[model samples]
Target chain A: MKPSTVPASTPSLRQSSGRYLQTKWKGLIIAVPYLWLVLFFLIPFFIVIKISLAESIIASPPFSSLLNWTEDGALQLSLLFDNYAYLWEDELYYKTYLNSIKVAFICTLICLFIGYPMAYGIVRATPTQRNILLILVILPFWTSFLLRVYAWMGILADQGTLNNLLIWFGLIDEPIRMLYTPFAVYLGIIYSYLPFMILPLYANIEKLDMNLLEAAAALGAKPLITFLTVTLPMTLPGIIAGSLLVFIPATGEYVIPDLLGGGNSFMIGKLLYSEFNNNHDWPVAAAVAVALLILLVLPMMLYQNVQARQVGVKT
Target chain B: MIHKRSRWVIAMLCFGLAFLYVPIFLLILYSFNHSKLVPIWGGFSTRWYTVLFESPEVWEAVMLSLRIALINATFATLLGTLAALAMVRFGRFKGRTLFSGMISAPLVMPEVITGLSLLLLFITLADIIGWPGARGFTTITIAHITFSMAYVAVIIQSRLIGMDQSIEEAAQDLGAKPLRVLWDITLPILAPGMLAGWLLAFTLSLDDLVIASFVTGPGSNTLPILIFSRIKLGLKPDINALATLIILTVSIGVLLAAWLMWRQEKQRMQDRKMASRTDH
Candidate 1:
């Protein structure tokens, strides 16, 4: 180590100064995004909660304030459970919630059934071929979402392409009522979200050690047994991740259900839309939002805990 | 690796791809259909395309959507890049987990919840600060940036994780300032990831309807919002024409990007080979 004779201001001093500046820059870099998210993402969530507790009024902005000034210069607060109570009282809300969950769950299962094998096959393909297959899977994802849904309308209408094809094949006498039904809603969701399911599952399955499967096979394990015991267990995390990705968004999907699901197919998203836009009830809309948030976030909170535990074990 | 079940798996994959593409293919094909009704095949014509070109409402929506998408993609990329750097490079800072969670929340949060909460926030902010006087372009742009940033952050973070850190460290060791190192070395290497993130953000902003619907005021109709309302009434051939044009434009753009990246990779490999030969 140099003991002496080094200049005071040449390299070492400048380097330390640079390090100090770098530290300040680091703080600023992190703070920008951190503060932006807090201001925009986190604080808005609180506002939603506040609005949900307030009463809807026929006024500008359309919600009564929860706070009031008292005659004695003290503050008064009023919060209403009426919106939530109304949500509970209405049997339609219950049906909407249950229907949304049912739709989301079924769509998720369909995505898994369709996506898993594709992912498995792609992972096992030659490297060059795998890239092409992955690109093909992602191509539709880049296209306009609303347009994709609209494409289904053209294909599933009473006189749509599917019915036309079936009629031509002598499979049916009349045009089947495929559009404006729960079945169309299911088809739309599965089609839109299948890529989301496949990508994560592909990532997980691609990382698997093929030797483990080969070892099982050498030990007289059937292909089905090897897959069930090894592959399925190994990709459970991915399965859960992919399922949640599809299911959560599907639950709150407004576009697909509104377009494909006729008046009878009640979804919470469509209900929330009507509450806000048609009914002009901001508080009820907020309440619906809160209910949906809880429905989605509870599973996520549980998943987070499970993930944390898994990380802990791994470390 | 070819097994007894490989054939079944391959067949499933083929079926899945066909299922995914057939509808989109039909939509494109029918865009040029001369018939007013979709299923009945009339002789092919360019009438719908001409109609789409002449529609002022669609053009207005398209212009507005493009403007928002441009602005949203830029802001999302900048903020998302910063957030990704914070998560990847800042090590274990305080509140890192919270920071990450907030960044990722929009990824899975229902669009309805996101839109509603954001609209509420804008309303409250306007009441308190008297800014953002109305919900339209500004509010919609901000909402798009918020959610799209999460996606951009994920893309950039994955890219950062795959990158070699030694090059950046070496630049710093050679007396380059941190900012200089980032600008010169790190950013150049991250350009592809950043471009991908930008494109992703742009497409997301363009495709977004639910959030835009929540935040937009009158006269600020985005393309998706316009198409959505129109489709609710009925599907038209002009709409199909517009969709076909968009798909064509987007696919060409994607293919061009892929080709450019492939060329760049090849050039890099050739350059490395030359450098290795010179070294020997």
Candidate 2:
């Protein structure tokens, strides 16, 4: 191919006005999505923040901002930190936040452990079986999520199918309280999010080099050593992806905890819902949400940094 | 890696698979259970399935939900593909990074936050414009479209990124207008991604509970909302029956899609083999 004959400042080298218009139109087409996101997602987050700083009034339009204490012992227009204090100083609030993170972390660990193996197994399987297993993982996802969770209720309740089966087999003296327990809550979350964990792991681990394993064998490394030295490091990307998939959603989960968790079992998500709906306290709820966002942001930023580093290496 | 007994690995795999399948199988079995107390088998019966057919209110809700999901899925797929096309065609610009981040945000943002934000927007809109929203099914459908479109956008973007861009340029060189170039070339080429996006959005709309619970007003219960409320009150065998029906339908749809793809691939291989033979 010949190099360009035109000099850098030549008129003939300039792009046409018709092409310029097309490029500008194309730029607007790109702008539409970003504009929609700013309006819907980002602006609402600021509004939530604004309202969170306001005084809590009972059940009568929660969005009266600019708060300060008045002569009549009512709060008026100015700034305050009590809503955040309600989230932090209270033992119940801290407990709920800890509980949300605790559950999400444990669930992410379990999902990684379980889903990684299955992903590996599926990748190793014949194409037909791989397709079949993948379909099995995705099939439940296609059904209504609440209905699938409801199906768990039928299996986990005191007089549930699991108990009845145990009773028939003479394995239990009484129908166990499997429903409305923390264990039951964990079961539901793990079951629901298993597919999320599997899919990401599948995407990454499926690309792993089989020759490495063979080479390790030829080099006289034991199976376990080879696994630790080769496979785990190789699959770390998949592990991170799978963990993120499980961890992020599990943190903000409301339905599983609400249905399966009893009154004493207070996850942060449930607490936020109650504050908004049951307690009619919007400001406190917003404060809790802001705190939740803060808690998630640190780890999420770290994840992005790591991903960016990886992309930097690749490119 | 550990060189555990193959028997041990096999047993573990079997147990896990059995755990997943048995719960679902039990749900199916209980659908026909004569016992109303669910799980306890009073006897074998077809009573729950029959009960499903008798409820006109249930039918009405299902029909309404179907209508909403179809509408939401179609719009989500269309907007998602357009967004994806714009994303890929306009590859890199000043704000491309910002655009990608915006599209991915809804996928990660909590459903509670999404629902509440949408609800707040609707209320503000009513105060401003006196609009066509009491924040009912229409609001819920639109909200569903917003998030579901993100997923569709992701899928279509990946598909477009992997695709050959030369085909479109070829169409343009053959004297196609920009609109006609897209319609005759890109639309047909991206049809599979579009269809996949439609299915993804439809499933997402069907599965949504928290967002729908927030936005759905005045007696409109999608099946998930109905099931959620019912489970909170107490479990029922009819739910099992309904779930069984849904599971079966989805499995069939997936299997059909797989079979079609396999046939298409096989035909492609045959075509290649024939062409190579002709060349030889």
Best-fitting candidate, scored by DockQ:
1
Please, what is the whole-model Cα lDDT of each candidate in the order they appear?
0.87, 0.76
- Lowest summed-lDDT stretch of 10 residues in model 2 chain A? A12-21
Q: Which stretches of candidate 1 lie over 4 Å from their true place?
A: A1-22, A71-73, A302-315, B265-280
Question: Tens digits of per-residue lDDT for model 1 on B42-134?
Answer: 989999999899989999999999999999999999999989888767666799999988988898888888998998899889989997898
Q: Considering every candidate listed, which one attains the maximal lDDT?
A: 1
- Could you tell me every candidate's TM-score relative to the true structure? 0.92, 0.90
TM-score of decoy 2: 0.90
Docking class of 1: medium
DockQ of 2: 0.42
- Residues A126-218 of candidate 1 have per-residue lDDT tens digits of 977987898789889999999999999999988889999999999999999989998999999999999999998997788688998999999
lDDT of 2 by residue, A253-289 (tens): 9998988776667788788888887887878888888
List clashing residue pairs in candidate 2.
A66-A77, A66-A78, A67-A77, A67-A78, A68-A76, A68-A78
